[model samples]
Target: MTVPLVFAAVFMWAMWDPTETLEDLPVALVNNDIAAGTGADRLAAGDEVAQTLLDSGALKFDAVDSDTAKAGLAAGDYYFVVSIPSNFSTTLSGIGGKTTAPALISITYNDNNTLLASSIGDSVMTAIRAEVVKGTAGSSVKTVVAGLDELSSGIREAATGSGQLHDGTSELSAGASELAKGLQNELVPGTAEAADGGRQLADGTGQLASGLTDLRAGTDELGAGATELADGIESIVGGVDAKGIAAQLAALKRALPNDPSLRGVVDELTGVVDGLAQLSSGSREIANQLTDPNADYRSGVNELVAGSIELNDGANELSTGLGQLNTGAQEAATGAAQLADGANQLDAGAGELSAGLSDGARQAPELGDDVAQQSLADLLATPVDTKASNVAAAQFNGPGAAPLLLILLTALVPLIVFMCCKPLRASASQPRRMSLRTWLRRVAFVGGVSLLASAACTAIVWVALSPSPDPAELGKTLLMVAAATLMHTAVIAVMFAIGGYVVGAVTALAGIMLQMFTFGGVWMIETVPGLLKWLNPIMPMTYVREGFISSFNGSPGFWSALVIVVGIGVVATGVHLLLVRERAPHDEPLAAGSQPA
Candidate 1:
């Protein structure tokens, strides 16, 4: 009984409160860090760290002179001395290195004084270092987040620009597409047709050219003939004058009338002479028409030659224009193809950029939420920040006391009952224990008594600590305490039934030790060693501790805890009744005896 009480007291004293040891621990802090640069680039990391530590209230930090801190460590007056180097802010802020060098921190410890205390001091320094890094990173994250915000703004602007570009390109593509279609369907074909017509015209002009050359040769022949006719007519006219022609005709007529036979001959001769004169006059008129200078065959031939030359020139120009048109048509088709392809590529690129920007806009709200409280420079410099939050917080100084007390009561209650109570017997005279039913009834009575005691303790802790202000949470606390107590009574009573009083007391001590290692009442179960974590699910106190935290914090997991605690009691009772082999022989009375090792 005394042993169980002592064990409970020691366990409670060691881990009843959270963070108290860390808060009260004496440590010396010295800040010698200073900014190396001027303006906004300047930063004092040591002073910032000191301010954060003070704000968080995570440590019992003392600002002391460097020499005094060093003396204190040597004299065992302080756990350790923490001195911030002169280059602390300069190195961390990278004002000197421009991000080429990493920040460095130095801690001095007197391990000879107390190794555990020194280790703890080192841990505290590590935590301070972490806090400093967090603050610095938050500043940097604020800068980066701001830059991201600006980038997002820029992307949105770019998206707007891209949309306008898309519209312009779409119209361009449409025009290019139509141009390509026209080249393929109309202009190129029409140009080919015009080229064909030009070829036909060229051929016709060549034939006309040949015809003109023939006509020119023919005109030369006609001129030569006309000149010969004119010369012949002139010669004939010169020989036959009008007066001589008339006298000749008269003589012929006079001769014809004189001679009868001669008359016939004379008449024929006159007719012949008259015919010759008429032919000569006609020849002169023909010569005059052919040789006239103002409007004659020669001038007409010259005009014809000029017209043929003009026609030939015009045919050549048409052929040349058609050739250029054909070439231009092909070039236009090629250009349209290139334009369409370029427009398509531009449209695709713009669309992708726009889509990516839209997605980034969609995600901006979440990112903005993360860096809402930070600044632009900090976000840019340090883009990531790490933080921690507890879902089920103790929130009070003595919230852990309930779980710690519950664990104690679980062991100590049974120890006290067994030490104080009398054993069940069939009768006073016989002094032998009754059947297993008698044992169970006595265990039930002890459980009832333990429940009342546990409830009372729970109420006391609730009123004093007010771990949870809610009425529902207080009710849950009472439930957990009662369940834990009943289970403790069942398990310890079962141990006594199976192995007597010593085993019961030893079982209680063992249970407390298991609870100490496996229970998450003080340190989180996740932070414990692997083996202890492995045993965490198996320990009944694990559930009780979890239940207490949940109840106080208004979280879940109470039902699960209640189920496990009740199951433990039921199983323990069953094991006690069925599995225990008492030391007494068969058909003999049950009596107290030592358990097997």
Candidate 2:
């Protein structure tokens, strides 16, 4: 019993070998990436290749001492060793100013493991190098792109410079000819003309400098105007927090007279209040929008502020018009009250004018359209759009390339389960007595198994996350992990029902690898061969990984993918059961005691 238990434990551990760390591999890494970038966080681009290679579990490392590292290939231990050159990051300029860099990783391997080691090193190194190149492809491509742009600009400037030289030479020739002709006519006049020309040249420099100053000032003024507009918008938003509109509406209601017809008065007040509510809502939207502007250039904001100035100017005009009308109505009311001190007769005509003025005053609702324009201006003026998406991506993807723990957990658990249970085998009575109790038991069993899968997988996932990680970011990642675990269980459950442990485990593994290539988008999907590419949706891991990513990002794709993957798993399980039933072996029974007699 003790021997069997030991054997079983060892078997279980081997089947569920969870020791997936970079330290397990047999490769040597030396980081010598030295690139020029201003910021501390600016990618030391070359180390990325070495780091990725380390991430793959193919290589085992024996630390290279400084002496050996400098000398090139180290003494025995590693199958292959990588040495990155010191000038790995610096841009190269070949003869004729052609831009390219020579960032070579010299890989040397021992002769003992040459063929196998070379093959492994090559495959792993190829994948890592591809990613490093692709991830910073923007920088590389930008070098050429920017160089081309600069070259084009330089060429245009050179063309203009050539024109300037031609013009100056022509002027000089004409001036020289004139001077010679004048000298032939006589001396003092030509010399005096030369002095005048020198004075004009001096004036030309002064004028050119003045023109440049003017250009600078005009730009400064535009910038200042934009800043002022932005400041004004900030002030407005700060002044009118969410409480502002409600406060104002309450104040206005408080100010309204409580008439004999209370309902009429309340109704009248409510109408104005509704309009105010709308205006307030619109203002809030505008304020929110100002926090993130769409324009690439700050100058674009200037245009918006200029539009605001126009709008404010229009509002001032409207305000003035309202004031005049109010004044006129008061005068009319005063005249009517005095004329008819003894009667209500004057009230009617005064009321008529008052109504007209009130109606005119209510036109302030239209002010919102103009105010909304100001909001757009506010957004433009603020220049809040920041170009930091790459920074954000690096923050997330840089420190770690992937969740290897999850990858291993996903890879290993099914293997263990399948081996332990010896996978599913078809039987004759499988389809005969399908009942509600059977269905319920199967579901319960699947649920129990799923819970176990989640527990087992999540331990690995949480262990990986235990090391310091951005809390907010890791929270999202954990959510994705949880979702994926559930997804994996659902797939496992359904597959287990139809095909049992062995077949399900094998198929699931295949699906995961396929996803790693095609669906993980690890390699360029477009580069995948047409025949092989069709396998993407068929791969369960494709759905699992995409679903997880989408969930973390709050994408609808996650939910949609979840439904599809779960649904497929469930359907496939039933199909698997049907196939199993058909293939099941039946043992024919004979008379019970006949053999004994």
Candidate 3:
């Protein structure tokens, strides 16, 4: 009884509430991360994470340098070491920059120290990663919110500017329309009238040139006539001898009579001769003035004729240019009309653009308030929070494992009993055969003692561990233990009866190991090897362990597993009765009451 209890005590004590002792497990935390950004944007992610782990009390985390952490982990002073690199914060802060890389948190574990230590480190790292992600995401979102606020402001200003632009464009379009209309209606028609006037002026200038040419010819004839008349008069004056004739008239007047009337008639004849001389002199002066190169009349007439000819040529050129100008004006009128239409279209487009900008400004989100923006950022960063619940939660590891230990201890009782004792008390040399009823009674007595011993071992472990406080669960577990004890006892009895004590002991120990391996004790059934898996369903320990576990967990498999365990015990006992038969009369020893060689 003490032997089974001693083994159970050692196993239970080792596995009892392992998680509760996690704080005693030494783990090194090495923080090498440099702060990222400056001033308001500064973040010390490694320090923050290290502090959180320390404060959480999840594991005993010792803050140490990298060398210390490594030495401690190697020397088994620490179960695991968590190291945050120098670029941790910097890499996290680079999320929105031109280049980005994942922030690495390294965890090193020594499986030699403890196999489960690595799994614990993995869990701790996962939690730390989540926290880092939340913090970094929140910061990134805040930056995005700030940018959006600035964007909204810029859009509002643009909307106002666009509105002003629309107004300006409206005035510009109106002015352009007026200019186009003036060009088309007033300027174009006025240019055409001016061209017509230019053509008429050219015709008038041509006429004036022709008239001047005729006047020039007439002036030439007049100059020639004047010269001829002057020459004839000068000759007449020379030939007539006007002065001598005047003297002769005066003499004749004196010879005729000294009377006043005779003298007056001679004087009148003299006056006529003198007047003819004066006319010849005036004609010579007029001819000289008309024909002289230095005279104004001849020069003026020549200049006038040359000027008219040049004027007429200029007028002809002006008329041709005016005709071209008129054609150009007509084209300009059509172009101006098109320009006015284009300006109107431009104004319409500007109005639409202004309205679009205004609508955009109105629709833009208002993220200006810092308080509201931060709150929004935080909400967006961590959208979902998880709350976990376990329906069949175990308080400690000891209570959940008590059933497996009880089953193991109970199985040990029958093996130890059968190792020293025989299955049947009758001697092999006996000639008379023992009745089945007597044989069963002898076996029942031994089985009863083994069952009592098994019950005591199981009860001791159950009470010490207090696997379940409920009387119903304890009762069910004890019933399964009784069935397991009987099954092991029958099975081991058959082996010892057939193969003697040494073989029976070896086979019993081997069966125990095999049962443990296949019955979800050392490893789960699914993970066990294929040969073991095939033997798992038939193993008596399988139902016994399952029944005990089901009873503790308050589940449905207890009754079914209990029935199976009882059935296997019945079969093993039947096989033991059939296989280990009493020796026959001839098969007995040669001498009665003597042992067989």
Candidate 4:
């Protein structure tokens, strides 16, 4: 009895605070990792992971060289060993650079240890991996955030430059528009007016040339009339000389009768001769003046003809020049208008582009601030957190597994007692009969004692724990425990009753061992191997644990466990009844039979 109690106590205690003792686990740490470079590249990921482990008190780090760690693991001195490669930090630092190989940390654990110990080591390694990833990713993210800030600054500068360009183009466009207005409103009209004046001047010059030509012809006719007048005067002078005026007058007075009429005629003739001579002299002077090249009339006429020809040529040249000037002015005006349009278009396009750049610059500060505040690693971090929550919290350090403990104790104690006190068999003597009632009564007594044991153990545990459980939960716990105890004792009794002492004890022990492994009373069944998980549903202890936890914590699976445990007991009892028979070849039924005959 004492041996069974001790066994159950120790087994339950071992799994009670499995996670709490992890800090005491022996792990050999070999930090061979080095920094990537000096100064800025001095990020060491492995060192950071090791420091975090030390700071958080997550593990008992036994710092040692690689050789010592490896030897210790081989000799079973250490449960597991962690080794960081020399290029670990370097590879991590070059993540986005040219490096392609993924950084790795090697975990060497002893396979000779128990499966539970190895599983614990695996969990620790997973934590270390998380720490390394967080540190490395955080460092790389800071650099990317810095680069974003610089890009934003460059965008702002570009916007400023574009704005200046727009201002300059706007001024150019205004100037060109003004020039076009001048051409249309002032210069074009002024040029047309000047051209009209040139046309008028040309007409005036044409009139002057014609008037001068008429003056030249009138001078030629005046000179010809003067010459004819001179010829007439000379003829008059010749006739006076032929008449010998004074002598002729004297002869005529002697030969005449001296009449008063004849005398008057002679006197008038004398006066006429004198006047003819004077007129002849005057006519000769006029002819000389008219024919002379130096005279005013001939010289004036020659100068007028030469001047008129010059004026005609000059007027034609002036008219031609004015026509060309008008054409040139029109071409210049058209060109100015085209230039103004082009400049205005250039200014408008530049202004719009500059506005877009300014808007971008305005937004750049907010974007940079947002990017600078957040680290890329924080956004992209992948963290693993393992939580071991107890649905039915343990009352004491080692009594949380009370349900499993009670089951094991009930089965073992009964089987051991059955083997030690071997009951006698019935003889084939006078009137032997099977007594099912007596067998049931004996099984009931053992079940009652098993219930008492389970209740007493739970009470003791409850008193020992800090902040004792509520009364409601305690009452439920007792009821679930009592049911488990009855089922366990009944099953064991049936096995012993059907299959004698040795066979029954061996079968009970084997079943208890399988239940310990399959029942998920310690670690989660999912984390265990597939074989153990597969056996979980079939094990009776699995239901016992589930029922106890459900009762205490208000979890599910209590009904299922109760039904399965009751079914198992009934099946065992039925099997015992069928197997039990009169194997002694009795001739008569026995009156009182404690065992099968």
| Candidate that would win on lDDT | 3
lDDT of each: 0.61, 0.46, 0.68, 0.63
Better of 2 and 4 by TM-score: 4
Question: Which pairs clash inside model 4?
Answer: 431-589, 431-590, 432-589, 432-590, 433-590, 582-597, 583-597
lDDT of 2: 0.46
On residues 1-597, what C-alpha lDDT tens digit does candidate 3 reach at each position?
A: 443454454334334344554665677888998999899999887788778778866778899999887666544466667777787777666542311235567777543223345555566556755765554477777888688678878889988998898898888789878888888879888888888988998999999999989987887788889999989988878789887898888779879877888788888888889989998998877776667766788778778889998999999899889888888888887877787788788888888888987887876666678885776566547532222222221235334346556677777887776654544422365545546765576577667878889877766765765443332366776777777888777777766656555656766676786677666543444434456678878888777766765665444577888788778778877776665445423232223432221
lDDT of 3 at 163: 88
TM-score of each: 0.47, 0.30, 0.39, 0.38
How well does model 3 score by local distance difference test? Answer: 0.68
Give the winner by TM-score: 1
lDDT of 4 by residue, 382-462 (tens): 322222222223324433334445445555655554454442232344234445665555456555655666666667656
TM-score of 2: 0.30
Model 1, span 202-258: residue lDDT tens: 878877877887886776676567667767866776686655756776776675557
> Measured by TM-score, how close is model 1 to the native structure?
0.47
Q: Name the runs in model 1 displaced over 4 angstroms.
A: 1-186, 222-242, 247-295, 306-310, 340-413, 416-420, 423-597
The true-versus-predicted C-alpha distance at residue 489 of model 3, in Å, is: 52
